[model samples]
Target: MKLILIRHGETEGNLNGIYQGIKDYPLSEEGKLQNLKLKSKLENINVDKVYYSTMERAKKTADAIFDFSSSAIYFEENLSFNEINFGLWDGKDYKYISKNYSEQFQSFIDDFKIFKFPEGESFKDFYNRVSEGIRKIIKVSKEEDNIAIVAHGGTIRVILCELLGFNYEGFYKFNISHGCYSLLTVCKDSAVLEFLNK
Candidate 1:
């Protein structure tokens, strides 16, 4: 199975340097243009199945691909591919979180896997969710199938971490640019990373 993971485009939260984990922000004008380019990039590719988050930003990105691709999409937000919920930090900028809650921020920086947001989920929950989602996708798809998934940065990171054998705490070690796509090949015994942050 070949997996194509496409991160959602930029958003107002991104322009303002705010945390957008589940805040429901839409794509910015620049993001729309990015999606246009992304659409053009994948317009001629053959996709067997498409999956996307329910969030508008991701959905819109998937819509662009759908408008140009030859396949329909399946929603994964209600299943296992939604963005990590930043909870109280949603819509807040790094400056605000660091200034108002320095200890929590530092704790998160220290140990992302264990640090729990005030009302948010731990990284473990999200990691497992993404891992399961990818496994399920692979399970349902044939080895020769090409699959596309439009999701958030965190979700993509988790999937890559699991596939690449990186720890969840090191999710920051790699970057997944907005509107960028990555390619992965999964065999019955091994997984190969073709490219990342593309």
Candidate 2:
């Protein structure tokens, strides 16, 4: 089975370099352009099932690609792969969040293994959520269908690391772009990364 993992197109928060975790922002004009580019790139491939996060950015991007098509599109709350929730820092600027919540944010950056947002879920918790969703998707995959998932950067990284056995420290190395796709081909018990950050 072939799994195509796509990161949603750019958002205002992305261009602004803000921590977008789950703030629910829409795509910017540039993001729309990128999405169309991706659509053009994926044109002839037969995509059986399209799944994405419920967030507007993800949902909208999915709609763009899978729109006016016969494919079954599934939106799942579980697919909303988000970073550690910033709690009190959710909508604030990153610099402000760092300045105000310096110690907590530092710990979070330095040793994410132990640090978490003041009132947010831990990295372990976030990883478990993505893992559960991945297992479910894998179990449901058939021999012929091609699966596409439009998800967040955080989600994509977690899935790649878990499925490919990449070390935790190397998790951020995936470096995916907005609307870019990463391909993974899976068989019974093993999977190989076809292309990453494409």
- Scored by TM-score, the top model is 1
C-alpha lDDT values of all predictions: 0.83, 0.79
RMSD of 1: 1.9
**All models, RMSD in angstroms:** 1.9, 1.9
Which segments of candidate 2 are over 4 A away from where they belong? 68-84
Give the local distance difference test score of model 1: 0.83
lDDT string, candidate 2, 40-92, tens digits: 88888788777777678887888787764563544454454544465676667
| TM agreement with the true structure for every prediction | 0.93, 0.91
- lDDT tens readout by residue for model 1, 1-198: 888999988998888998888788778998888888888888777777788877888888888767544335443443478898888998899889999899899999887888777698788888898899888888878998888999998898888888888857568887889988999999975789998866
Question: How accurate locally is residue 161 in candidate 1, as Cα lDDT from 0 to 100?
Answer: 85
Model 1, residue 111: distance off in Å is 1.1
Which runs of model 1 end up more than 4 angstroms from their true locations? 68-78
